[model samples]
Target: MKAFDWQLQKNGYIPMSGQIVDASLVSAPKQRNTEVEKEAIKAGKTGREIWPNEPNKAAQKDMDARWTLKMGGKIRYRSDGTSLPQIALPVFGYKSHIAVDRRFGFIRESALTSAVQADGRMLPRLVTTGNTSSGVWADSAYRSQKNETGLALRMLVSRIHRRKPAGKPMPHNIVRANAAKSAIRAHVEHVFAHQKNRFGLFIRTIGIARAMAKLILANIAYNFDRLVFHQRA
Candidate 1:
C-alpha cells in the first residue's frame, strides 16, 4: 500500500525501438555485469560463476517470464492523450498495487494486489470497509470501469437509498455527497503530482533495482521534510 511516482519506457529492459534502448543500460558498461547478476536473481536459479549445473540463462528466462506476464506490457500515450496500448508497470516494484483513497490520496491497505487495472478491485473494497454511510469520492479512473469488482462501490450506493421509506426513486443526495467528498479528495492527486514533478520520477532509470533503491531514499526524504519542518511550520 505504499505510494510513489513512477515512470514508463518502452524496451526498457532491452530497447524496443531506439538507439540507446534505455537510459540505465546505455549510461554505463558496468551495468552489463549488473544485468547479468539481476537476470540470475530474477531466474531464481544459481549462477555458474560458482558451481556446476547451477541455474543458468534458461532458468532466469523462465522466472522472468512469470513476472513479465504479470506486468502485462508497455504503456504509452498518443499525442492526444489516448492510451496507445494498455500496458502498465507495477509501481515501485510492489507485489500488490497502491491503495489510493477516494481523494486519490494514498491509503495503506493489504487487500490491494497486483493485477491488470487493480484499482478497479480496490476502490469498492475500501468503500465497503469504510461502510457506505459517509459516501465515497473518486476520480474517473474508478468510475470509468463498467464492472464493480470491489464491494465498496455497491455498499455506497445501497447506503444512499437505505431509507427509501416510500418508493422515491434514487435521490440527488448521493451526487451532492460525492461532490463534497471529491473536493477534499482531489488533494491526493496533487500529492502525486508534487512528488513526481519535484523528482525526476516520470522516466525509467538505468536499472530497476537501483531505481527502486533511489525511490525508497526519495520517499524517506519526502517524509522527513514533512515531519521535521513542513508539519511544524
Candidate 2:
C-alpha cells in the first residue's frame, strides 16, 4: 500500500480535489466464551495466559478483535406507516478506516483497528498530506474540536458534518448544510459498497494481524479494480 501511494504521488495521479474519510466494520466470526474469559480478554490477557492448559483453544481464541454495537442495519416498520426504532446489533470484528480521493474515488489511505476503537480518533491517521487541495470531508463522527484544530494546523478546510446538541433539534440552516455535506460524503460509501458487495469482505481469521493482512490485500485489489474502471472509461 505504501508503494501504491508512492506511485500515485510520483505520477501526479492525485488531482488535489481533497478526500473523504470514513470507516466500515469488517465482521468476523463471533467467539463464544465464558464471562470470566470475556473479562480476561477485556483486561488484556493473552490467549495463552487465559487458557494455559488448552493449547488448541488458546490458539483459536482471538483477543485482538473486540466487539462493538453497530446500529441501523435494516429499517423495520410497524404494521401501520411508522418505522420502528433502530436496534444496536453487537458485532465482533475489526474496522477498516479509509480515506478515498474525491476526484477518482480511489482508496488513498487506510488503517485497521479493533472494532471497539472510536472512528473519531482514527481521523488524523487516515488523512493524507498528499491531497494538495487541503480540503477534507467526513461524517459527524469525525467532527470534534481537536480534529477541527488539527485541520487548521495543516491549513486544511473541513467540510465535516456537524452534530446536533443533546435534547435539541438541529437548526434548519445547519440541517441543510449537513445534508449538502452528505452529498459529497456519500461518494466514499461506493468504495465500501464495492468491497462488501463485489469483493465479499469479511474476516474468518482469528487474530488482528491476519485480519489486517486480508484487509490490506482487499484494499489493493479494490485499487486495481478502480484503475481498471478509469482505464476503460
Candidate 3:
C-alpha cells in the first residue's frame, strides 16, 4: 500500500502540496457485563474465570474493545432563549487516524488504535515527512504546546486551530485564524463521510488486528475511487 501511494506521488497522480490530519471513531459492538462480572474483570480476573461454570465464556466477550465518550453536537437554543441539554454519546470501539493530501483528499497515512487513545498522540504517526514548506491543518483537538513544538522541529507549518481557554474568550485574531484554517481543514471530513456513507466502513470484527486490516482495505478502496474521480474531472 505504501509503495502504491508513493508511486502515485512520484508520478504526479497524488500531489504532495500539504496535508490535513483527523480521526474518526468506528463503533464496535458493545460488550455487556454484569456488575459482578465487571468487578471480577477489573480485579484482574480473566473473563473466562469470572464464570467458573462456563470456562469457555471468556471467548464470547470482545476483550479488545474499550468504551469512550464522544461529545454531542452544538446545543440549540429555544425560542425563549433556553439552552438544550448536551449529551455525550458512549462509544465502544476503535479510532482511525488519518493524514490526507490537501490537493485531492487522498489519504497518505493511517493508524488504528483503541478508543481510549488520544487523537493528539497519533499525530506523529499519521503525518508523513514531506516538504518543509507544506502546512498541516487540524482541529483544536490536536492543539498543544508539545505538538506545536514537534511540528516546528519538522519544519511543517502549524496551521492547527487555537483552543480557547476555559472561561476566557478567544482573541479576535485567533478566532479569525481558526475560521480560515477550518475552511481548508473541512475537506478532510468529506473523505470520512464518503467512507462511512458510501462504503459502510464500520468495523464488525472483535480484535484490533482485524479492525485495522478492514480499515486499511477501506482506505485503499477510497484512494482508487478518488483516482478514478480525478481522472474523470
lDDT of each: 0.35, 0.87, 0.82
Which lDDT tens digits does candidate 3 get at residues 1-233?
Answer: 68769877776866466889999988888878888876775576766677767756676666666789998886455555456678989998888899998887788899999887999998888776763336999998898888898888988888998876554555689879988999999999998999999998888886788889999999999999998998799
Q: In model 1, how large is the Cα lDDT of residue 26?
A: 10
Give me the displacement of residue 63 in model 3, in angstroms.
1.4
Task: Please give the distance, in angstroms, between residue 105's alpha carbon in candidate 1 and its true position after superposition.
Answer: 7.7
Q: Which candidate wins on TM-score?
A: 2
Q: How many clashing residue pairs are found in candidate 3?
A: 0
Question: What local lDDT score does residue 142 receive in model 3, on the 0 to 100 scale?
Answer: 93
Residue-level lDDT of model 1, residues 1-233, one tens digit each, is: 13322211121211111010000001111212355566665556544442345555433321211122233544344545455556444232222222333322232232312122344445544442432133444443455334232334454331111221122333568556555555555544443454456754432333344444544554444444433442365
Deviation of model 2 at 205, angstroms? 1.6
RMSD of each: 14.8, 3.3, 3.3
TM-scores of all candidate predictions against the true structure: 0.36, 0.92, 0.87
Residue 39 local lDDT, model 1:
62
Q: In what order do the candidates fall by lDDT, top score first?
A: 2, 3, 1
Superposition-based RMSD of candidate 3 using all C-alpha atoms, in angstroms: 3.3
Ten contiguous residues with the weakest lDDT in model 2: 74-83
